[model samples]
Target: MKISPSELISVLAQFNPWWRGGHIAGLPAWKRAAWHELNQWVTQPPVHRAVLLSGARQVGKTTLLLQCIEDLLQQGVPAANILYVTFDHPMLKLGGIDAVLAAWREREPRAEGIEYLFLDEAQFIRDWGTWVKHQIDFVKDRRIVFTGSATPLLEADQESGVGRWHAIRITTLSFYEYLHIKQLALPELPPLRSLRHLFDWTAPDFYRVTELAAPYTGHFHEYLVRGGFPQTAQIESVAQAQRLLREDIIDKVLKRDMTALFGVRRILDLEHTFLYLCMHDGGLLDMTDLCSNLQVKRPTAQHFIELLEATHLIYRLPPFGYGKDVLRARYKVYLADAAISSAVLLKGKNILDDPTALGVATETAVFRHLFARYYAQQVRFTYWRGKQEREVDVVAEVGGQIVPFEVKYRTQHTGVRELKGLMELCQQKNISRGYVVTKALDDFGLLAGTPEGINIMRLPAPLLCYWMGEAELHGVVE
Candidate 1:
């Protein structure tokens, strides 16, 4: 069915209320960390390339775009020059980009100056990459910003968008952003430059920081269950929030987006694979066991895993080693967010009661923070396992320096003996510092008298996450 130009223009006008002398309303003033990165690209792009924001659904991508539009209006930019349209709308979906733009131009023929176009859910448009590339190459004095819930821009249609667009991933809110959104009045502490700087902190510094962050302890557990999605983070009821997360974020990606974008025919198999990952979050992947338990072939299970990762539902961490050894080692998987596992497995506040479950969630949270913090630096994140089944949870290779972190989120006090994996890795690699994430606030300090003069700092998981989140928000470098 061919859609008429008048029909498309009506949809565009509704989306861009400012075009009709109205304003964007009912949006929060606060912004995510990605806002800083995005603002730079929109206002003063270093190069003349379009910007693409990609992430899982309900991560507030649309909200961020709306915020940008509001800012531009305030700057006194002509409202007609800006076009905000989302393909999610059925009418717009029927009217492809060319038809929509033609309608827009028909309504406003003054296309003489720079035009800013914000396209939402652009993956629905067929050959969107080629279309965007053509705009970048042929069109002059025009800027384009698009958003997608999937990674089609980088995967299937990447060749067309190779150098035409800059990709920025918008992740779930961090603990710091979560606190701000919840409007918690916890006292702010001095910023710690980076995770590496904690090694140089004195005894008093550690004690002072821990005391300052004590007020956050009561809320950290709730944050774990609620997760970082802005929409669900503020819901008063934890169960209701988790339910919404499952329905809105998890289910949409698994049931609808997977089938539409990736040709996933066996939805049951994909759902079961995700559920299994949730049950064993932060565990090694055993392909044979997973295939047998799911009653699917090896290739089918592998394809499901790939689809999950592509949709940003899970993260896969390879083992730390050279070529052949790394190839043979099993990959450890973690949900993109801790709250996801909790939502899927129906673990609410009761999750905190189960130490084992709590530990897994905490480790998953820690990995997410580390991944977000160092991802921009191109740092390689992998786990290490030695003889006797000793293992380090996360080993970050930064500028050829190996920093090992082991999560021991337990009530009892941890000694050097329990951190055998961290200690052994430090000794073998001649690294001077390591970290152990603990459960109790009182367990925050350095473990002295270790072999090879290694300094292992035991930090509470909540405080560590808070500081890491803070550092990321501030863009503090080591």
Candidate 2:
């Protein structure tokens, strides 16, 4: 059945509402939650030659891209001027970039500044970079934005989009966006702790604002135990939610993504390894132990972990290499998102036994929130494990200087001495600040340093998460 180009256009024309896009895209409406980022992308003209958006399964990449298309159309671009295609749809893959343009040719050739092509699940297209480049060669004035869950991770064909893509890695909603989904106003994060020490300085209005958020604690707990995947928030039954998280997101990543992208064959073993990592998501992982438990060779475990990482399912920390004393095999492992761990490892009251698991989930959520804000700038963040045994939960570059952070679930505490070794490393590197973020305190409780001007500020965790969402990781640098 050789299809003519006109036939192809007609087939695509049936999905024409998708071409109307945004409100017209005949799917779920764009979640109001993602407006901030979409607005940022929309308001700013394309800086990179093309924008590449990535995220976990069904994180609204298509809807967001459609809204982005609406923004383009509103800017005076006409419908025929734009090409829309599903480069990859898990259910039935169709319409690669070239095929999209080919179908469009049946209608008419692109008129200047009129044609914009959006390729959803772009990585599925064979030689996609070449296809788009071919378009760019002829249509010198054009726009091409791609949407995919698995970030191509700097691996694109040389034919078209080299040094051209500004990567926008979409993620599950942060607490900030979640609030927006509920139409709540929590634009700023409060002080870290609710300590009485700061009460004397607070005004009555401040207390009222703090009181307004009392309900969030319950939802926040639910978010921690169940996970932060968007659909997880919609499902009323926690059990059903967890099932979707495991079957749909987790397995989809392992089976479809890992195998399709990385050629992974021992997928069951990889699933087992992932379960092991989820159960031990926050523990200090020694890679050799993983090999022993999974009954695989050490290198096999390492390779599996690398694949897990490449697909954005797992994250590993280097033993903060400041001293010659740390073991190469002792880096800690964290699942990329807390919900992934919560989807599998958390059940009923069992989550409370290791209540710190909530903190782990929160930390992973925070890391992901912050990671997206910094990833494009080449900021490498990892954990710190000093030779002398002190540790920090997260580390990142601030104004080209490294900063150490410690995350705590403590409700009535101020602690940072534990990150002493990491702070020393910060001082050695002339880093700006050492921070201990927690839930208990409303104000930053300064930690006394080792008399060498090694500053430690026990600050609020929610503030950091909020700031990251606004792309303000650079805001608190010093």
Candidate 3:
């Protein structure tokens, strides 16, 4: 059902009320820190590229776009010159981005002024990459920002992007952001050199660090169940949060977004695969078992997994290998947020009391932190599995240096033997230090070996995740 031009004009008027000599709507005050970077790109002098903000569903990409527009309005960008359109609007499908903008221009023909155009849910537009690229080439003195759900648009834009598009990914809230949202007060954490080596308890100041971070034990527990999606973060009741998570996050992605975006026909198969994933959130992906469990063909199982990743509902981390086919190795799959797992599996009951779920959920929280923080960088996040089934949860490889992180969610002393995977990987890679994220213990010291060996650092997971969210790791990784 194509909409008439007058209908689009009416919708455009509603979207850009400021165009009619009225006040711009005030943006939400609870801004994500990612907005700071967007402001930098907007205010920078040589703003050539279209700023692209991409993230999973409900991670506040649309809110971030509105915040950016609000900032522009506050900075004296002419309201009439700015255009904000959500591509998913039914009327928007009648005419594409170019047509709507053309109609807006026809309504108010004013040249010699810079315009800021924001297109939300840009993936809905057909041939969006080419259209965006063309806009960059033809539109002069115009700053454009696009927010999308799918990631393939990234690859397409990269091919034609050249100096025309800069991408910034927005993930669910980090642990620190969660804290900020909850308004929790915390004691100062012991200073660290960089995020990569933040848990380096090999340092002599380990005792002081442990004492400082021990107070937030309960908060970390809540974080695992609540997770970091801004919408569900504030809901006090567990069941209520789970309901919203199912209806808002899971159902939307599985029912509407996947079908609309990827043309997924067997939604039941996709739902089954996702349920299996939720049950085994931070575990290895065994397609043989998954196929048998879901009663789907191998290709169907693989298709479901790929589609899940495309919609940003899950993450698939490959095993670490040197100069070999890493893709062929077994992969560890996890829900995009810890709360998703809790909502689907635990029904929003706090997992900290349950040892089994707590361990996996803790690792899920750690992965979310690293993912939200370092995904834009040139870091390869993989897991390490050695002989005798010794494994490290996360192995971050940057510039030929390997940092193995083991998640042992116990609040006691973990012996050297328990760190077999971390020790072996450090020895194999000739690295010095490794970390174990613990539930509460902050024990940090070295395990001396014949001649020399890697230092074993035990740090609190909550503090580490919080610090990671607060700082940038790109400079340290380089």
Candidate 4:
């Protein structure tokens, strides 16, 4: 059942409606925060490398590609010169990339100038990395951009694609991006260059910022439960949104992509492991206990975890320390989005009523923001555990400086005793500043009567996420 060139051209025509003199429809009016970087790379690449836009399923990678096509069209690029095709489509999969290209060249022989190829879900193509490398090395006046749902696109061909392509990860929406996607109206605050910039602010300045951020506080719990997927951001019903997330994001990755890409045979075992991680999200992982409980071997459980991470369903954080200390530590596990936990567990809006669940979800959200903000800067995120079981939730290593953050998202007053881990880490590391994310807006300020030299800011979780998201959008860093 081979697809002919004509049949492939028919499919391509359907995908690329602009070739028929129709506009690219269904484009989102508001672009993602990643759009700026991606657009720049596509239009004016710093290097002559192709762009690989990678992320989990349903994070709007396809939409971003379509938006890029629209931008190219607006710039007076001939519609036929811009090709858009997805290997996910069965027809395209049958024909492969070669057939599609052959058909395009045959049909558009007279077309000239730069050609843009937008390939979606490119991992389905066999030896895609080598194909792209050949194109980059041999082809001229051709700019290629591809999207992948899994990291195999990266892991499988790192050596070959070392300098041939630039990878840009499109994570689940940040709180600020989520708010914009939801079209919520709120007051505009002054730009924040970095989280560290807040430490230098006076009491009046901090309060004024917090007051301006008051409207965002009400949406924090919602964002945590709904997660950051653009599709679910505007869904009014919590149950419906979680249902979509579970079916679209979790189920597809576990059932289909794992089997197709990674040759995973025991989907039930993978599902069980993911559920266990959801229950213990933001907690340290014990593979022994997990294997014993799931009645699986150590290697099998380890394989499942790796496959999950590859699919971008989970993130593993190693403990922060030097040499053997880091190697000997058990890693902490977190779902890419807090809403994944909520969706898988069917926690819905009730998650807010459960304080323990609320705390774990908040910590997951905080880590997501931190990872999104600093991943490009080569920041290493790890947790710290000390004697008597004192642990800082997240310890970020930026340029050899240790910045510790602890989450205290409880309604009660946060006393100095509660910030023991952050304070201890700051003192031991001689770190001048740290942050304790709290639940109340009134908790926003500097900790008083401290250890003199060390300073800790008690910021609300909403404000922290919002500001971090905003700062990342603006490419603001210290």
Candidate 5:
């Protein structure tokens, strides 16, 4: 039911606790990276575009927007000039984005300052992109920032927000960020140049690198199980975290987001496919096999997979190839969060205690960290599967430079022979260097091939994963 403007203002007052002459009580600390970006966008010279913030549900999109509001208030911006509206609120939903803005204008028609519009869960407003475009086109003084759950907004922004929005994706925390969030102490890390040299077999930094990362090895196992969701990472109990993940992340995405956005009928089939995909995390997926196993038609199976991917619940990694040919190759499916798989399949059990499970979870974790590395960048990351069932976990290509990486988490598989897939791909692509991510083997050396062949390098998994998120990816502080 539609509520009056007075009720709407009351709701706004509740969400913006700072408007009540005090700071927001119990506001969780915001991520440094997100805070920095918002600060840059706000304090800089006025730009003509709105900043589109997108991520999976419960990844702290709302919290980040609230923190931005707090930041603006602290920076001498009037509280009245900052408008924070949650589109998903039932009362707000009844009036839509335009009506909410109109109400705010009516409340203070003569307010004379540069206004900030923070629209949270903006996908709930129908045709939000068109409304935002209209606002920015006609009312150029206002700075508009909107957050989406990543299902509809991604598509909407592409259609209506072209060249008018700066998109920022707030993914789950990286292992480095996870450490600081959990208050865990890590030893001093080596320099970024030394870490990058680990990818070169001829470099002499392998021993020092292992020594630097030794203290954080055990925490990697925890990161894999806990995954990177902000709230789940904060929970101390594994079982409790898993339960919350299953309910807040998994079930909600499937039942609420998928249905509302995709008009999905027979949700059980879609859910079953998701569960199956989680069980086979990081494994090659054959559509024919999946269709038969799920007892659904090919079209239905394809639709379900597409919907899952669009909602950011899972990611499909295809084989490296050019253009349309890449679509023909079989792809591997990975849960967006490692904990989604661990929560469903292992029931919050510590993966470190189980060797086989640990290996699989490690591969999933590697894919996630790599995904975060290139999420907003122009790089394309894929998996390489060769004949004889050989495979590499991640193959990244940027500006025609192909870097193949293999994740071999088993203690026994850190030898040169285990990186056959990466080496073969590197040779075929004419790339000189490759990396092998291992459990603990930190030594790197040139693996001499037959006459007329090139040498490849192997690096430790812990160091590579940490470096990928920390320095190599440009998101972490060195």
Candidate 6:
């Protein structure tokens, strides 16, 4: 169903006669702090053909696009010039693309000007990327932005000669972005060399945690458990938050979005498998063992895992393969958001109390939280392991350098024994600095460098800023 450019505007005009619906459509005010990517996107000179945004579930793709659409329409692009389609609604039978153009033509039967096209959950239309390419070639005057979490919509554009597509990957709100929403951190700040270090896991030991007890520790702890997905931030009741994310989010990913994208059957088995994953949320993969548990062939189990990964509901972090990379070690798997892990179980404290399940959960939580914040630029985060019996929890490389860090439950000290092992690992890998980030401090902020240069820091899980890399301090440091 191909919609002519004129028809797209008319259909959209019904939804927003004055280009005012998205902002005034009884929608929640966009809450996350300035997404660093979008901040860079809107200002940077546009290069790729179409601006494409993709990400995990509930990362606010639809919300952000609506916000951008409202602004562009108000800026005076002809309503018809802007083409908006969503595979979720406007069913393919009713009008789909062709119907959209009919509506646009009805609205402004005879008008011609610069046009914009915006789409939501775009994977519904068959071959939407190729369809989009056809439309793009036909209408040289339109600017398009499409949002979808499915790998199809995300990957299709890349496959179909996507030379003109500008890609954006949205992710759940970060701890820093959450703080921004609560109005906890100021929008701008003076040049502070210490602030940047405080944000990284390998933060210099300059700040402390007791400094935050007066008004913030409890708040931060709650964030640690629930994560900063948009709905979690708005819902005050813990139980309500859990229910919403499970039915509305996780279910949608497994049933609606993923099924449509991957064309999967045996969804119930997949559901069971996912629940098993929730139970072992951050555990490493063992196909033979998982096959016995799921009563499926190893290939089937592997297929299920990869399918979960394809739609972003889950991710498998490959073990830090030493350069020899013998047989590429098994990966540790985790849900993309911690909120899911927290929601799937009734015992909130289980993650901390049960060491086996909890360690992986805690590690998974930190990876998602930190990766969600800076996976794009100025950061190259990877896990580490070697043939030797040592491992560093998180290893990040920035500006051609490596920073290794270990996560420990005790905050009262750096747990030197744990770090002593990591220090050896770091030296072996030629990575610098072994950091122990913990909950043992009595201050509201970070701890700077220890005298020996192995940056040690005590940090409460949720509130510490994530100014990662030197973006937080442009020229003062890097």
Question: Against the true structure, what is each candidate's TM-score?
Answer: 0.97, 0.82, 0.92, 0.98, 0.92, 0.82
Q: Residue 358 of model 2: what lDDT? A: 67
Of 4 and 6, which scores higher on TM-score?
4
- Number of the top lDDT candidate: 4
Q: What does candidate 4's lDDT look like per residue over 301-415, in tens digits?
A: 9889988887788899999887987887799998899898878988798889999999999999999999999888899999998767889999999997888999999998677
Clash pairs of candidate 4?
none
List clashing residue pairs in candidate 1.
Answer: none
The predicted structure with the larger TM-score, 4 or 5, is: 4
For residues 331-400, what per-residue lDDT tens digits would candidate 1 score against the true structure? 9999998899989988788888998988998999999988888887888999999879999999999988
Candidate 6 lDDT at 54 equals 75
Give residue 318's lDDT in candidate 6 (0 to 100). 63
Better of 2 and 4 by TM-score: 4
Q: Supply the global lDDT for candidate 4.
A: 0.88
Q: What lDDT, from 0 to 1, does candidate 5 have? A: 0.74
List residue ranges in candidate 2 displaced over 4 A: 1-7, 18-48, 89-96, 107-112, 149-153, 156-161, 184-213, 321-330, 346-353, 416-432, 441-444, 448-452, 470-478
lDDT of 3 by residue, 241-290 (tens): 77788888889889988888888888888999999999999999999999
Error of 4 at 247 (Å): 0.8
Please identify model 3 stretches exceeding 4 Å from their true place: 21-26, 45-47, 155-158, 161-163, 190-205, 322-325, 444-451, 473-478
Error of 6 at 334 (Å): 2.6
- lDDT of candidate 2 over 294-366, digit per residue (tens): 8988888878887777676777776655556555447677776667776776463355456576677777776
Candidate lDDT scores, in order, read 0.87, 0.64, 0.78, 0.88, 0.74, 0.60
Backbone clashes under 3 angstroms, per model = 0, 9, 0, 0, 0, 33
Error of 3 at 286 (Å): 0.2
- Which is the winner by lDDT between candidate 2 and candidate 6? 2
| Model 6 quality (TM-score) | 0.82
Q: If both were scored by lDDT, which would come out higher, candidate 3 or candidate 5?
A: 3
